[model samples]
Target: MELTTSNPAQPHGMTWLRDDRYSWFLAGMMWVLIVLMIVPEGFDYQRLATASAPSSGGPISRMLWLLLLALGIMMVSWRAGLAWLLARVLNPFFLLFVALAIVSVAWSIDPALSIRRLIRLGTIVLACVAFVLMSWHARRYQNVVRPILTIVLLGSIIFGLVFPALAIHQQTTPELIGAWHGLANHKNGLGALACISLIFWFHAWLTREVRFLPALTGGAVAVTCLVLSRSSTSLAATLFVMAVLLVLLRSPQGLRPYMPYLVSMLVALLLIYTLAILNLIPGLGTLMAPVTALTGKDTSLTGRTEIWTILSEHISYRPFLGSGYAAYWTAGPVPGADSYAFVWRMGSFYPGSAHNGYLEIVNDLGWIGLLCLIAYIVVHIRQSLQLLEIDRHQGALFLALFFQQAITNLSETHWFSVQSVDFVIMALATTALARSLLEHRLRLVFGQPQPSTIGTSHGMALPLARESFDRTPDGGA
Candidate 1:
């Protein structure tokens, strides 16, 4: 009934759905689902020993996926305007990337595995879309995400201290024996979550969205967990994001015009760093000696360089289309088997990922996929800069998270993984960009009319501020 009467001009319809109780309930459920995906308590580490075995998630996970899918369908069906909004907001490059993943199933070395993983990926995408549509209001983004990070950060600290046997990793090598995992399956997972929590809480504090006491407490907890996890990559990424945030907040207006140049330089630097890490550049190891010493890591990067060496050879075989979506890593035919054997022999255990996002994309979907990702990032960065002109606080938050993920992928791959936390943040960034683009277009087509302020009292402000850009008809362009 609501779907039939929904109007584009009155996009925020279904007044009953805007009830405080319903909004909070939806937010809580979505947050819980995200946490479970990132820190799956039922994950079986033993499965890592067998690369060829069919991996199965817990019943709880299966049910959560179904619920998320159902909710996504319901939201899109009930809010026809949301469908229209997404039509204009969704990035074409990202859609092409997803399409390629689906198409890869036909050529996949392990068709069954590809299909299963693709299905899981579809579920995650659906949930992300649902979240974006549901939170299509200014400031709702912070309100929805803040409590989630706070609860997760506090809960992880408490669980790690109270249940060390369950929350801390015990089977790690003697050097990493005391590392804390804290509800996640691995210490690295905990570290990633902590890094994310630190960024969110810090942004909240900087924006004064929450009281000082809670924000400071949450940030402290996040930092402690990050340190205890003993993940050098996470620590480095957290610091990198913080530094970027500091720069952005210091002079957002002055920095806006140079954002494109800044992003390009950052990407170029990352490429050089990657090459250095891979030993492709002679004498690079000597240059990185100081960094290694600071992080207490050897030149091996804990065997990631070796994994990259093996996977690089395999990427050349199917350099165009790849071994299909996540199909090459399994113990299958030819190159897949060879690569798996090499990694197992080198590490005496499963390596799990390519340890590099760019390499992973090439391995899963080939060079075209890699290009699609680059295009997606370029577009996202441009849009985030535009957002900074209007909403400095929210815009800075998006950019900081985007940079953090970019850096994190250098040492850990989560590009297209199902229910991956990094991928989810990327999705959220895409959603924010889409929302901003839609608003700009609307202002252009509809003229600079005052937005209906029906939901402002409920903490939902229509995203129609004209503080950033010129009001000329072609200004949005």
Candidate 2:
């Protein structure tokens, strides 16, 4: 009997379904899900009381969860072999952190709350996985990101103007009464989204992949939202990322050599800033006084120091493994006595986040968890630089994102939160790093030339693993 050979380009019995239209449709659904996940208010989830609690299995939330699960199932079915996909995508440090979160349930203050939040976190990770699988192709990946952000940014502006009550937060402090939330639950959320959109669009413009007018329009929209939201941290982080990007783009060949010095300078600046905030250095407060006046804040950073003081005291109670994920901030209509007092000190009735990502991680998982997170970030940074060597445009984008997250984390707590836009962006960067590394490893192992997808040009494509598999005679070993 003669053996029949299958077409290497189409594997896993998906050849019949391998139409560009199908891929685009799947990607479109994934993009919509991302927008919904990041900005739930865009879909009016904020209007539903059921979307309030982390542990509340409300109908709307349950339905959304089912929808996400269905999407993941569809992606896995289309791709075939979830196990193999996961093996390639999973980063050890990230996986370890997730594992730690799961084990934290054993020691959680509220076991039920911890389990529920863990499930939500898992859902977010799985959704991210599905996204990576669907948009594995470079052009497809850019298509997924660019159009989604453009629509979201433009839609935010339209929604804010048309439905001010829903899109803007009216209950903010007097200083922020007219601030535009723009399809988000809070003004800062809009600001953060705008900041990242600015970075993405700016990269697209600088690379000249898109036409000048459209790129300029996208950037303008992002800047307008960012300014209207009045989020100082987001604004500052955006500017900082832009500066770093400019430097890297100008001297791509010198990036790796200067990375060590750049990292040292950043650490030094952080230390000086911390010292100045704590008044540990003489005359530092005086030096910062002018800067503070311009930013409309005091040396105390508008009571953030007080909140940090309170959190630091509580952190000592569980130094190694703090109150389980999202456990400490759950008391009642009001927070527990200590947290309530902290909020009262901040002149707010509700207990909010630590407002510092590092502190929040320490509060949730302790120093050990924080170290794991640091390692994960370092690995990603190194990997991002490696990608830059092959594809400067994509590398610069990844690095800019990394810096933006790092800087924002100094003042906001979105490191590993469920369904947070910041976390989702971080997940995306991590997925890209994984893809880059996988491509490099496969090239080394098989002694094959790098695919055309790896580039150092304006339109650099992603070196998709599927392409490598398809090129093989027997669909890869």
lDDT (CA) per prediction: 0.68, 0.66
Identify the runs in model 2 with alpha carbons over 4 angstroms from their true place: 1-22, 40-58, 73-90, 252-260, 267-300, 331-348, 443-477
TM-scores for the candidates: 0.83, 0.80
> Where does model 1 exceed 4 Å of error?
1-22, 41-54, 172-175, 252-260, 278-300, 330-339, 443-474
Worst 10 residues of 1 by lDDT: 459-468
* Candidate 2, lDDT over the whole model: 0.66
Clashing pairs in 2: none
Worst 10 residues of 2 by lDDT: 453-462
TM-score, predicted candidate 2 vs. hidden true structure:
0.80
Candidate 2 lDDT over 1-477, as tens digits, reads: 000113243233212111122466656665756675566543663552233434254586577777886876666555444225344545668878889999998877777777877877776666666666533544345556767776777888898788877777766467468888776666777888889889988888777768889888888999999998988878887887888777777766645678646754764565455457655477787767654665556766666787777788888899899888876776343555445666566556453688777778888898888888888777766667667766777777888887788767766778887646778667766765666555444443234332233222121111333444445542121
TM-score of 1: 0.83
| RMSD list, candidates in order | 5.5, 7.0
